[model samples]
Target: MQCMNWKLSDIASVLAVEVVGNPEALIQRVITDSRIASTGDLFVALVGERANGHDFIASVIEQGAVALLLTQAPKQPVSVPYLLVEDPVTAMQQLAAAWRLKHQLNPVVLITGSNGKTSVKEMVRAGLSARDGTGVLATQGNLNNHLGVPMTLLSLRDEHASAVIEVGANHVNEIAQLGPLAAPSVAVITSIGRAHVGEFGSLDNIKRGKGEIWQALPATGGVAIVPVVEADSEFDGWSFWQDALAKHHVIAFGDMANLNVNRGWQAWVGVVERQATTEGQLVRLATSDWGEATLELPIAGAHQANNCAAVVAVLLASGLSWQSIQTGLSEAKLPGGRLRLLTPLPDLLIIDDTYNANASSMKAAIGVLMEQSAKTHAFVMGPMGELGDESQALHEQVVDFACEAGVNAFLASGSLSRSLVQRFDVQRPLADLAVASEDAQRLAEALWQVYQQKGSMAVLVKGSRSARMERVVEALVKLASQSAN
Candidate 1:
């Protein structure tokens, strides 16, 4: 298959920027980092907090960049083609939108919500790849935001048969802005929770903000793969998707007990049956259109079942057979730092779910920890940021669940750690439970003492992105390696 080539003139026309060099220079890719800039590439000079892209223009040119996207003109005359705009980030976004509008890729699936967006995107990409093997372009890393979304769309090439775009937002209307640029044919709403309540102000606002992606669907032949939510549940007072469900084709998944198949909403449904397996997640999914199928998922967790079900719904909606969908889902692999296991010592197992956290995610991680068949279990907690007014209450709820769930230790860090320690002590005193310390070294040392005295143990380290709770995990790994020697 041939690569996509965007001429300098065409890109400049789309970006509405001032060109400084050859207009006919061919471009195959748009890059932001100078370290990876190469031939036939358009290097976008983004002015970030730490570094300015213009400072590295000479290096990118040396790496054979065909064009430069910049916010200001170069200090000296340059031979390479360049487009000067008021803001390079905005210019790149505009170009990415124009590129998607021009190419019109098929089966463009958009996944959005508070949590599980990345995992669901990976599953859908794997499922779509099973369709033919031409190629499926998907969002890489955490590029579901405004800048990241555009970068993913710009990466679309000729060989790619389909695209799975992950659209993310912390504030209101962010998805509405990125959705149109993605131009998705199929839309999936993972779940609506208080993931970024601080930015949204309320759980109600988060529901409305995430629901914006449904607006980008095509008039006809559009498909929606959503969770099974009733008026009392996920769809409380949200009538937009209700109308879309009635008009467009639909595939819904969740607890099978909550749905009424006899009510004539025969949209295909994916359900994770009562798992009877010992180790892996046994997913028994039953869909009306595609019939029933059973498969063992690679990862095991209560939340994972819902994500995999959503993946199956997307694949079935894309017209893939049950066999192909199952094949793709079985081979799916999500990003690291989420329920990933790392054994720094022979007796210590780390449950790394440090990607990001909310009340829902925290509880889910705790559930994963409880499922482990280890001699001891400890939780290295961190603050849940951007929770707005409900931060303390929601965090207290997480603490309540951890204590009620029979956890042996709960060591918290961050600004909220002291008060949480008070709360933890009130619920389960230090005499009855393990100690909670403020110092990182003391925290790690205490946890190590408990594990060494109790035999094999599992530690769940998690927090919001800003909290950097991974430091605790790093410290533990270091101590374990040092002590083992």
Candidate 2:
């Protein structure tokens, strides 16, 4: 994407700054890191938790940055054009909003939640692109944090009619900072769960933080696509929908309810019942939007149905016809390592959900294994992190859930996971489970042997980001490749 030419005056008004130096200095790009500063780029010096961007001003200038946006006036100002704002972080957000308006592109959709945000974003993108000459831009990987949000906005191009940006935060105010940067024409909150429960302290704080997406919606008129999760219901009275109604105007896609999974992973949904299935229920879904189609999704577990529901709502809100939405969803593919199915060896089915795991996601993975009627299901679950003080209890609870779900064989990794081994012995009459050290490499070698011997069993591998569960997935893939040849 070619960078647009920007002037000091264009950015200064949005930032409410008094341009100091040459106002005519042309900025062709905006950058935050001094290392990437290039000729004609505007270096935005933001204050972060670890370091202040203002400290890198000299280096940014040395690298050919034409302008700077800083919170405080530099002790020794340089000849380069710069804008002094009270808070560079806020200034960056305002500037992004202004830049978005200046481009006159299609509407932007912002997605946020503790879980399933990325998947829903992709679903919406697919649904929208199936119709019109839609160009979809989304948050790459997990760059959903404060710094990541603005960087995603800066990556937008003229061809993009709309963007699906994911917003994530562990503390208060993080989402607030990201809200305006994307300036979504429609905002979607997937669901509020126990993510970052340590920092947020209670579920209440998580709800409040997620609510920031609603507060960020532009008043000129916008749609808020909120899943009818229990926590989200609390804010229903104060949502943007009410504000839109007061103007004697309503968005065409407002308040989509009901979703039913039809013949395959396909679903039929109405706006009202859409929020009802936010928890868990596997039902045949048909929708007026996507007429008479059935979809059995490639991904496992019933929770995915809920995630799909959110995607459906976002697509409908974006004005996609039922046929296009159904086609896009039917063609949707899962991300690598996110419940990716490796080649089957003999009767063995390997499920690699090792990308990341939390309690809720873990349960979903286990559920998939339990549903395989004819196969003995084995689970290799590594430690799920960020549970804070509830880590032990939560890990133990997983062991209990696994037993109840009828998981035939269980392997626990990590120091915290060892607790599962201990609980399994006491909870079950026979201690059939194995405990691997926190080292994933060693666990991978051992799991391969188990797979070779237990030829007919289905195996599931899962863990948190820090656990490196991909090592196990790689081992399985290698074994499958060798067997095929």
Candidate 3:
């Protein structure tokens, strides 16, 4: 938050609100939570299920907020200007959209998809920051929603050369509506899978919802980075084909041979070839924008192949040299719980892909688990959520996938876990379990007991956000640490 380049009048105009106090007051910062309210901050009162920002009005005034933007002004006025709007949340979003355009956070990359949104966002941020040799504004944590997008934009300062905003949606039209607030120069969809099929209704609906990002791009001079698919029929079939006729540039990634783009558009293609390495893999990417180069993808996992390719396309589109892309990605730190490797004992390797889960991601984790050399390989997970009517079948597919991948043991917890155990192709886990979360000692003891049965073992743990699976990993690691001591 470099001092906001805004005044009460400017915000009022953008938000279609009327100022109730000094219109000339300048805003140095904008905050929703009154707890963080301080001098020069424009505190916008928003309504949430748990609490209402309006409740904190007096507290914000006491803390010296320069102004207030709320649907209703407080009964007692204080030492601050106030902008009364129909809705302060909408007002804040209006300000964010306007601010992003004014600041010129060039090439604001908006990433959305079923999986790999965070990893790709991190990679793009690291790649761009490395390429530019400066700090870049990227989404912090998993704040990638309606409120999160606006908040992310408002955090941008003059120093940032670029911004990577992760846009997420549980249902249709969520990403579509976030476009103006994001003011993205580029938009990329990582992949569409069954992660949130419940809210989206079906895969085709998911395609339409995710494809809305492209529509959010500026009609002219915008860029759409999409994974190459066998067919674009699902993206509103004829409508998506007509999109190829639109003015924006399309950069297709993945197996380019499978995607056809001969529709009189300036289409750019990026291809990825991967060779496995111990820590990660060497990605050989060739793109129409920057020609050809091979870089070591810092993250591990065979499933990361398409993600690496998509990042390369983005980096290439941003005009980054291969050197910066390689170096920056090497230094890039992904947010926790995505294929994180842990060695509690010499023979026991733990793969934590617990960031979030869907059928595709779980299958991918199983692929990674199979690559490990341990005699005993266990996959521990909770039931995947938001899978809609197909949840039961999808859960069974996990068991089938593990079997096909030749996994040695399966350990899971959730209502569906027991049923999953019934379909396993390999031996069941050595120990019974209860959910351990936030590093509960009992959970660690249960997980550790399984590794006790194997001379050398590798375990993969994953679950959806609802599963709180990282706690399982933490508990096991803590128990391992205590055992080592």
Candidate 4:
């Protein structure tokens, strides 16, 4: 959309491919799928483990794709412009680099970690916008994997001053491929947690995957910002944290370091102690640059403070003034379905955080429920996925936290969560604990019945993506709407 039209030769030179077709062929757009190919668009046929893009070449060209970048020769020769490369994925990365240089855009910031990447990206976008009113582009959702990263960069426009790309990986070497394409001027590792530890095998592998963000930093003096972790935490092995400190610069925040939550507001004021290479921590008083002088966030959670802290670090690192940061923070809202508060009913408040769930996020949501002044707190929880061997243990841990947090009514859905509820009953007698059958609909209906009988209550709905917790949210909202009618 930013008036991108590069010569075939230019792209060929960047990708180091032999241009065998029309040298003057103009490519205004880049696409991976044949169904979505448009006129004058360059279709990059990447070969995946399951299917090869070369198989779709003829179909894509038939759909008005002007050119193709292929890893292998086409079986049937179509008189279309083409570039033959050893690897189309690598070639796409090369094209992304060339496009960035050609547009002269602001430095890209690459963000990755086991948790909080999306939140950090949003914060960076907000902070950067406050500083310069520059056109900013960020990943739409959790589109931070290998295919998602290139697609995000390809969506960039010449008018955009900067881009914040979120990278997620479940295995090793994933971030290594994404780093060069993003070409981050600054890299931020949000935190290392057991997000996909099952796929990676161990915590060390998880650290190795997250550390790729730092490894991708350009040797030309790039900065890395890492949050301060406990001395005993495994995150100390973060190469990005050490590498930036050794060569360029590193900024650290968090851990009871003169931080305060702005009362009745979303904004915060704190003195961030600048940790010099030699000096440990030195105080620099700073106020958030974005949002109301005092504001409240739409989403409720204690971990939000940590998420906000990471955002604060990104804004400060980006050179935004304190006032701008405050303004931006005030303006920021939670991404949809991440602790989204539905309208208050006469007797209940609905919390729809069903987008996804994990150990840390579950604790944060429960903490928010604990702080609310409700006669009773009800939770409709589903299983958390991808924890590998720790799935059952993690579920039990959440149940223990819930019992300790004083949730009055706990409705566990999903077989795994039901198993956790049973374990909790054996370990600690929870008076109001109910385990629903496999049907999420039946669970929602039962919860609605209880809410109708009770005069006042609060509800939290949460689960992994596969659990479709949003459906439960919809059912509850529908019940409330019908009652009003």
- Candidate 2 global lDDT: 0.69
Compute each candidate's TM-score over C-alphas: 0.92, 0.80, 0.92, 0.86
Cα lDDT for residue 198, candidate 4:
81
Candidate 4, 309-337: lDDT as tens digits: 66676666666766777676656665877
Clashes of 3: 0
For each candidate, what is the lDDT? 0.80, 0.69, 0.77, 0.71
CA displacement after TM-score superposition, residue 165 of candidate 1 (Å):
1.2
TM-score of 2: 0.80
Ranking by TM-score: 1, 3, 4, 2
Candidate 4 lDDT trough over 10 residues, lowest sum: 274-283
* Alpha-carbon deviation at 396 in model 1, angstroms: 0.9
For model 2, the stretches where C-alpha displacement exceeds 4 angstroms are 34-39, 46-64, 70-80, 84-86, 103-107, 132-134, 218-221, 229-284, 287-292, 344-348, 372-374, 428-432, 476-485
The TM-score of candidate 4 is 0.86
Residues 417-474 of candidate 1: C-alpha lDDT, one tens digit per residue: 8777778778777422355555667777778888778868888988988877777777
Model 3, position 177, has a per-residue lDDT of 88
Best by lDDT: 1
